[model samples]
Target: MASLIEDYALLSDLRTGALVSESGSVDWLCFPRFDSDAAFTALLGDSEHGRWLLAPEGAVDDCEPQHPARRSERRRAARAAGEEDPLQGEAEPDPAAEGRPVVVQRTYVDSTFVLRTLWKTPDGQALVTDFMPVGDRRASIVRRVEGLAGSVRMHQEISFRFGDGAVVPWVRRHEDQKSGDTSIVAVAGPDAVVLHGDRLPQGHDHRHIGDFIVSAGEAVDFELCWFPSHRHVPARIDAGASLQETVSYWKNWSKDIPQQESYHAVVKRSLLVLRALTHEATGGIVAAPTTSLPEDFCGERNWDYRFCWLRDAALTLEAMMTHGYEKEALNWRDWLLRAVAGDPDDLQIMYGVGGERRLPERNLDHLPGYEGSLPVRAGNGAVDQYQGDVVGEVLVALEKLRNMGGVEDHFSWPLQKKLLGYVEEHIDDKDHGIWEMRGDQKHFTHSRVMMWAAFDRGVRAVREHQLDGDAARWEELRDRLREEIMEHGYSEKEGTFTQTYDDAEVDASLLVIAQVGFIEYDDPKMLGTVARLERDLMDDAGLLLRYRTSSGKDGLSGAEHPFLACSFWLVEQYARSGRIDDARKLMDQLVGYSNGLGLLAEEYDTVDGRMAGNFPQAFSHLTLIRAADAINGHGQRAI
Candidate 1:
């Protein structure tokens, strides 16, 4: 059986990532690139379909101590009778540690990206697995294991089924003297995996089995590197040296993150997770590492989020830039320009990592979805939806770049002009909103407000930034948009803004009216909207839902849980409005939603008290950063 959604930790080479469970099973991984076909689909299907698990050879046991703190009881008896639990008396062991099972604690070797996981048996036997790259060479995944203490029996399960469990690889073993290491190579189509290390296990019916005993101080190592099947076998790699270098690289990268006042550790971890989701070479940030993890497990609401959405990328860049991560910000800016290069009319809402546009949605009927959700999807259907807010978000990002003193290249102005033109052409159209609802098109207020932002920023670029553009036309359009929204989107009876022009239902997205500078947070209208949201969208735990489902605006059968981003937006709204106390309280509770290791999923089931939807959502982390920035201010905030 698979672990809970929160049990997995993330590991990445910056180009792609894998989700490793507490018991040492890599259930989700996309090979070659972030948007590539799955090489391990077990997270969305059965383990036999695809997975690589390395752990102690035994059934998992849940051994919760009956008496958690006997010593604390004795100490409390010696002290006052009403004393609190000293452990709880302090902080709650960081909510990130809650529900995390005890395992050989694993992490990247200090400063390097190389991941090391250690496991020990109850009988004093130990196993160590180390994985790192060959120093920015070709696509490679290295694994090394050593036995220490008594004889440790280790289980190694490897499956290379590509295309969401459709293609299987042929396995073979070979010898290589150049690197003084034996190799086990698996070949299928254009993909090949080469394994190298000490005492390579012999193949038995397409499975490798081994057992080794080492003294207390002895060590053993193994490595695996993948390459194109047609390419010649690459030269031998130095696993130890590579591991050390990789650790150093990650430590240095992490050092660039800024320090902040409150929730520093959670913020840093969120930033680390955001960095892990980004493709290092291209700067394209994937929405999540896994696909088809249902919002409501066993339901039909599952959608793919592996591709990069322009809205998410722009907001992620804003969050990174706000926290003093200039290099990543600049890289993302370049990526944005390159991705939307060709023609304004051809601009897509989302794209592949390298900016490839054709992401056709398909179902993987062969493998059952996470928790039995059907028709596991790849690629996103929303790519074809007409989301007017995307261009607005891009314009906001470009303005932010200029505000931060990012040098404008020759292509920047032209790209902005093209995007502005697209927005202008479609500003009057009624299409899907930011939530990408599958219902009928309605005039979403947030989309119009962002359209106004587009025109407003474009006009500012010309008048304030001295850029060449039609300032008068942009100003006229900006005022026209604002007037239209004020007249039709606001509800006089409820004293709040509506989700769409034709409806009176409040949306949590209305909280962004202040953050986008659409209006002051303390403005009477904005405060009323916030209060209305609290009344209509608040879940039982005080988190804001994306919208009121009872209104039946979104055409879906089941209800969705509270969106983490929406709650963070509420936190930002509170902070901006000078309600610092409310903001701090909300921020603390929002940070508590993160699982052990400070990871967040797309949504939270307030009723069930668990994470829902895809794990480690980029939007959630990005919004967490934004909310933190709003609370702590620009420079003083932690990354």
Candidate 2:
């Protein structure tokens, strides 16, 4: 089995990413692009499903991993506040766990995607640096091993199962004509990768294994290159030079960030993560790298998130544009225009990295899911769903760009007009909300607010910016929407807004009403809604759930941990509402939830104190940046 989700850090070349575990296993990686078929699928199954392990012997294979859980700080805080304990029904700590020594330390080099891990054993210490070369399109992963102390024996094993672990590649060894060094090449169907190392491993049992030792002052290097099988093996490049270029690229891109006194460094890292998830060939950004990590462990909430979501991408751009990254905003604007170029009636919720449209979701029955969660899926079915908030997110994000002096070009303004026309046509329809609920469509309150926001921005473009649009008509609808929402979406008896117009349920998404200018943060109505959310959706773990699963709104079995994004939303609300101490306290806890390398997952399993769902989630990091800005007085909206 793979290590815990939080135990992994990311390495990216602005094309695709590789998930490297703390113990030096590249367990999950996709080739060529973010949405391509994976070459390392062990994150969803066993090692037989393609994985590359490079570490000291006995560090990964034979030893037992002990996870002895105790009460987390969130749980303790909830208990002290007299809230019901959320862990009562959870599983106890493992009985088979035993004490183990810690021998590995991991971190990324500052302002770069390079990962450095140090392995310490009884005999000696070895340092391994892993990264992907950027800007050159080499399509390779370079790993450098350096001996830091006395002699340390190291081991390397790689299994080449292509096509999502279904096809075993034909392996061959050849000597590089230039360097005269041995290299292993594997080909399956149209895909192939060449493994070049100081001492190439020999084949065994459809796998390759190599063993070597490094004494003080000795070093070894490895490079694995991926290319089309018909193409010649890519010529080797200097790994040391590539490292320098990659580092320089990331630092140059991130050097212009404005310093927010308290959370500057963390926000910079969060910004880098968002940038890494972006595809350079196309400006589309993915929600997360690996798919089907399971929102609910040992349950069926797993879904693929490799493709680019319009809402996620738009929100990511907003976070970037707020920090003066107008170039990224324009790039994403072009990508959006290309993706939804056809009739507005045919809009999709998401698209592939290169703007490919058809993403038919399917189950990979051949591979067992992570932690035995069933039906490891590929592609996202949410594309076909009618998500009303998506267009609004795009409009709001573009409005932020406009506020930053990004003038509307001929193409960009026309697209906004088309989007507003779509909103006008679908004004009376009921559709899925921001959560993309699998249940029946209802009058989701958040969706309506976003629709209102779309028109609000449209009206502002004409009235405020002298653009050519029907401001009078859009203003009428925008005003009417506020009245309709306040009338049907709020509860007079409880003085709070409901999740839908039909029911009195509270949703974490309602917290954003203040964010989009629908209401003030400290309005009595929003305050009442917050109280209801704090009473109902705030789990005993002290984090906020998206909404109540008991309402049967999601149409999924079991339950999920609190969403990290929702928790950050609460932090933003608190910060803006003058609860600075409360905001800072909650923000501190939420930031601390990240792994040692300052990366966050989609959700948090509070009972076991581990990260669940996708690793390095774009939602979690983007919301964290927003919340950090709110606390540091850098978050101000046109609303």
Candidate 3:
């Protein structure tokens, strides 16, 4: 089985990403683009489905008395030879099989996508550096292993199941025309991957396996490149040069991130995670890399998040814009215009990385889900749902970009006007809220608030910025929305805002009311809502849940853990309300929830003390950045 979700690190080429476990296994990866069929799908199944594992080769059972006896015998033999003693050398032990401690530590090489994992055993240490070459049209993943001390026997195994584990490729050995080195090529239909290294693994049982040893100071390099099967295999590039170029590219991009001294390290890493999830050419940022990692483990709540959600990407743009990344904002804005270019009536909640639509949700019966969260789904069905907050999110992000001195071009302003027109047409409709609930559509309070924000921004664009729009109508709707929400969305009996206009259920999303300028952070109504959320939705650890599953509002069975983003939103609210100590305390706890490499998932199982849901989620990280800014006195947003 694969390791826990938190035990993985991500490597990205700006188009796609590879999720590598701490023990050095590329268990999940989509080729060519973020929405492409996964070439390695072991994250959703066993190694036989698809995986690339490079781990130590032996058992290290310390409980065995024979180990001490053997060590003593080896020491005696060395002493008898009259030579200086050397440290005990053995193959790296498999922790699961050996019942021994195998400490695996990972971190990104500062401000870069290059990931380094060090495996330390009782006998020796080995370092595996993983990265994907950016600015290269050909999709490729590169891994280099180095021996730090003592000789360590390493096992390399690879299995390819193209098309999300639906197709097993025909594998064959071929000599590269340019380098004359033996490489293994796997071809299935139109997709193919060529594995090149100093010593390529030989095929066995429709798989590939290689065992090698690296003594102190020795190193080895491996590269996997993806291309169409019909096309000639891409010529190999210098791994050393690619490494340098990829590092330089990331460092240069990260140079502009403003420093937050207290949370500088985490802030920088969070920014990098967001960048890794973004498609360079399309500028669409995915919600997360691997999908079907359940929000409720062993439950059927798992949904594929590889496609780009406009709401998540828009919030990502706002986070970046706040931190001095306007170029990304403009790029994503352009992608948004192209993606929703047709009729405003046809705009989707999400799109493929290159702006392709028509993502039909279906089950992959062949591969088991992460932790047996069965019915592993792909292509989110949420695309068809009407999420009223989406245009609001986009408009809010563009407004922030404009605030940061971004000039609106002819295309962007026209797109905003069209979006406002769509809002006008859909004003009376009930639709799915920001959570993309599967339940029957209702006038979700959060969605209503966002619709208000949408018109607010639209009115501001015309009245404040001298842009083209019906300012009077937008202002009228904005005021009318506020009135509607105040009258129907809040409950005097409950002394707080309700989840929907028809019910009094408190939702974590209601925390954003203050964030969208709908109310003051310390407003008595917001305070009452916060109290209700804390009483009803907060876990034992002070973390916030999205809402009560017991309410059945989401139309789903099974309970979920607390959402990290919601907790961060609470922290932001606390900070802005002058609860500085409370904000800092909660911020510290939330930051501590990140994995060893400073990455967070969509949700966290505080009871299990592990990350849950999709790995390296953009929502979690983006909110983390905003929360940190708030705690550091930079998050005083004017309502």
Candidate 1 lDDT over 1-639, as tens digits, reads 456677777777888877777767777877788788887788887666676766656523222221222332334354456665444444323212443223566664543445556665654555455454523855666666665666565656666566777777888777666655567787788877776656566665545655444446666566556678898766557767877667776777778677788777777777877888888888898899888877865677788888889999888888877777778888887888889889789999998998889999988888877766777998888889888788888888878888888878899888898888898898889978888987888899999999998999999998889999998999999999999999999988888899999577888878777767888888899999999999988988999889867676677767778999999998888887788889899999989888766789999877556778888899999899888877887223221
Question: For all the candidates, what are their Cα RMSDs to the real structure?
Answer: 7.2, 4.2, 8.4
**Per-candidate TM-score against the hidden true structure:** 0.89, 0.94, 0.93
The global Cα lDDT (0 to 1) of model 2 is: 0.87
lDDT of 2 by residue, 1-639 (tens): 777899888999888999998767898999988888989998888788988888877666422323221244335456669998756687753322322213566888879999998877667889899999999987889998899899888889899878887789999987879878778899998999999888667788988899899878888989999999999888777888998999899999999999897888789999999999999878999999989998887789998889899999998998998888999888898999999998999888899999999999999999988877888988988889998888889999999888888889988999899999999999999998999899999999999999999999999989878999999999999999999999999999989999999588989999888899999888899989988999999877789999988789888898888999999999998888878898898899898899999999999988667899998999999999999988888345424
Kindly provide the TM-score of model 1 when superposed on the true structure, using C-alpha atoms.
Answer: 0.89
lDDT of 3 by residue, 1-639 (tens): 667788788899999999987767899999988888999998898787788988776522223434432343345456668865533465533464654325566778878989987876556788888999999776999989898988777889999779898898999888877678888889999999999897578888978999888777988899999998889988777898999999999999999788776788898899999999999999899999878998887789998999889999999988888788889988998899899998999988999888988999999999877767888988888999998888898899989988788899878889889999998899989998999999999999999999999999998888788888789999999999999999999999999999999687889999999998999888999999999998999899999999998988789999899999999999999988888898889989999988888889999988557788998899999999888888887447833
- For candidate 1, the lDDT comes to 0.76
- State the C-alpha lDDT per candidate: 0.76, 0.87, 0.86
Question: Residue 429 deviation, candidate 2, in Å?
Answer: 0.8
Q: Which candidate, 1 or 3, has the higher lDDT?
A: 3
Better of 1 and 3 by TM-score: 3
* Model 3: residue 550 alpha-carbon error in angstroms: 0.8
Candidate 2 residue pairs that clash: none
Candidate 1 residue-wise lDDT at 140 = 61
Query: What lDDT does candidate 2 reach at residue 106?
Result: 80
